[model samples]
Target: MDDLFDDILNLEEQYYKEGYDEGYKDGAEAGRIEGRSVGMKTGFEKFLEAGRLQGKAIVWQSRLPSQQESSTSAGNSQQETVQTVPSPTSQDGKDSEPRRLPPLSSNPRLEKNITMLYGILEPGTLSTKNDDESVNDFDSRLKGAQSRVKMIERAIGEGAGDKGSANRNRQQAQKNENIEDIGRIPQRTDVVMGTV
Candidate 1:
């Protein structure tokens, strides 16, 4: 009887361990799947939001030149208040000065951001994932988009600071070169002074 009871207890112990192991495996898989789904969803949302912000910044930057031109025009036409507002008969009808858009290459950073934005936000990009699209691919794209957008934002925030400084330095260097040229006598290549 003792031996039989021991056998029954051992069988119960073995079955319990097997059931626990199965349950643990199932739970772990489910958790992993859930985690990946959540991660993908969040990554997509971040990409979308970043794309929108970048698009807006590009649009705003494009409009800056036009706005500045219009303001300058307005200032110049301040004396002629009536004519300042463009007439319907004028060329380009609605406005005497036609609106201008910045070229795609106007700002390299902006262009990069816009390109990245479009690539990520285009139809079927996030809406429908490709069968071959792996989680790592999605994550990589998300990180790329985020970084590019940040770069663009940083550039916009810094304004034309670096560019302006570069321009100033270039002009100064040109001035120095001109001064050096002025101080030096022109060498006559056609005449050999020592021989002559």
Candidate 2:
């Protein structure tokens, strides 16, 4: 009689336990999938920005006159400057002369900043690990690279259109896009609907 009553009395508790276990398993699986998707998207965005910075650094380095060129120029101040346009071969093996940007004015400070920017963004040095330390380091380096880019842009008078505004417009536009992306994330309706 006691055994019969025990089963009858605990029916609600048993169902609760079973439901809890099932919900836990489902929640864990869903969380894993969502976490992975977000992680991949974030990692790709970070690396894309890093690659952009690296490319900028390479171009800036190329534009800055080399020490040899500077020395030669100093010695021959009267001669007209000659720009060597490299005939970069296309992927189809066609001879295509790439449009060359005029060299940046030779400034010691500008050259040092460019070199520093390249060093900070060196490809091999950045870690792709998702650990806390690596992520923090990557963020710091990225911020540093961005600040350096703004400084370089200011020095070279590239991105600043209006006086005293250095890339702020572009940065603000990017921030707005990111905010819109965040707003688009699907909210969990199952909990609200009492389905979980």
Candidate 3:
């Protein structure tokens, strides 16, 4: 009895140890997945920011060539020349002049596009119309799919009902045959009562 008790305790301890190890392993894997997802989110945000900055830089740079030519036109009036200032560049290829760009947060159009894109990517988000006709088109397609499903279900239900009716008839016929074969049963009372 003493040895059996010790053996059971040892088995219980081993079971708990194995359970703990598995739980720890699962937890570590879950933690790693969560960490990677967060890292991807952070990286995406940085990429968007860098992309925005690069876009701004390129747009401003494009206007420079035209503005420089217009400023050096030398055909404008003296007052125009005085008003127009030539922006100077630093020795290191960086612009010394500062230009103000519209804030990314203030662009309503871009904000709306971003919101729509996010909605498209994430489920349960608010739906927006890409266009007047496209929205209706999607709704129409959805309705078509639903109608097809309903038709299929009705066909299936009818098929199953037919099978059930046939089975019930078969069973009833079998029961009647068995009763008829068992004896010279006098069913005249019920038969006559039904006829009357």
Candidate 4:
């Protein structure tokens, strides 16, 4: 009968449609999971770098001489300096000798650069949104902060002359290693396979 033959011929097409629909659904779900994981990893790496820069800025700011000291020194260059000896015991009876960091040399330009660096890296000013504008803003701020770090390092004499060249080489090598780490992420092969 005609009806029986027609049904048999349509059977293969029906199965093909069902298989295609299932494949599409599975692929969509898998893609969503993979995309979310990659996004989270990327966001974590970016924020970690920002936090590291923020910590550096805080340490640098603390090392700078206080404004009061700078102003008084500027007003009286010939005054005799008095040194206060630290007491061995505090009021709580604990050893009070705290390790002190050497103050950065009082240079106005250096101070301004340090301030700018801190301002750029202020956590409140950064946004975590993934929209195009926010992403571009975050990227630009990150680049600015990185350049500020290099400038600060140079200002602090870490990048001075022959010794500085060696330090710079070491830094470059470290940066290359970081790049290689990022590159180690597996690339998607779906497009190539689809084309084939």
Clashes of 2: 0
RMSD of each: 20.4, 12.0, 28.6, 13.0
Give candidate 2 regions above 4 Å deviation: 1-3, 67-98, 160-196
How would you encode candidate 3's per-residue C-alpha lDDT over 1-196 as one tens digit per residue? Answer: 3576787769988999999999999999999999889967864664454344334334433334344446446435444435333345456545434343322333344333333333333323313444667555544543443343334324334322456777988898887686557677566554655454
Give the TM-scores of the predictions, in the order they appear.
0.40, 0.66, 0.31, 0.64
Clashing pairs in 2: none
Question: Distance from true position, residue 142, model 2, in Å?
Answer: 0.5
Worst 10 residues of 1 by lDDT: 97-106
Candidate 2 local lDDT, 1-196, one digit each (tens):
3576888899999999999999999999999999999999999999999999989999888788784466456747844554434565555545544355678998999999999999999999999898999999999999999999989988998864355464676677777686568668677755766555
- Tens-digit lDDT string for candidate 1 (1-196): 3676787779988999999999999999999999899968976776677567556555755555444567667767774553444555676655665444443335655665656655754545553453455545656666676666667656566433456767988898887686568678777789867785
**Candidate 1 — number of clashing residue pairs?**
0
State the weakest 10-residue window (summed lDDT) of model 4: 78-87
Candidate 4, residue 66: CA error in Å? 2.9
Tell me the RMSD of model 1 versus the true structure: 20.4
Of the candidates numbered 2 and 3, which has the greater lDDT value?
A: 2
Best by TM-score: 2
Residue 66 local lDDT, model 1: 46
Candidate with best lDDT: 2
Among residues 3 or more apart in sequence or in different chains, the pairs in candidate 1 whose N, CA or C atoms overlap within 3 Å are none
Query: Model 1, residue 92: what's the lDDT?
Result: 62
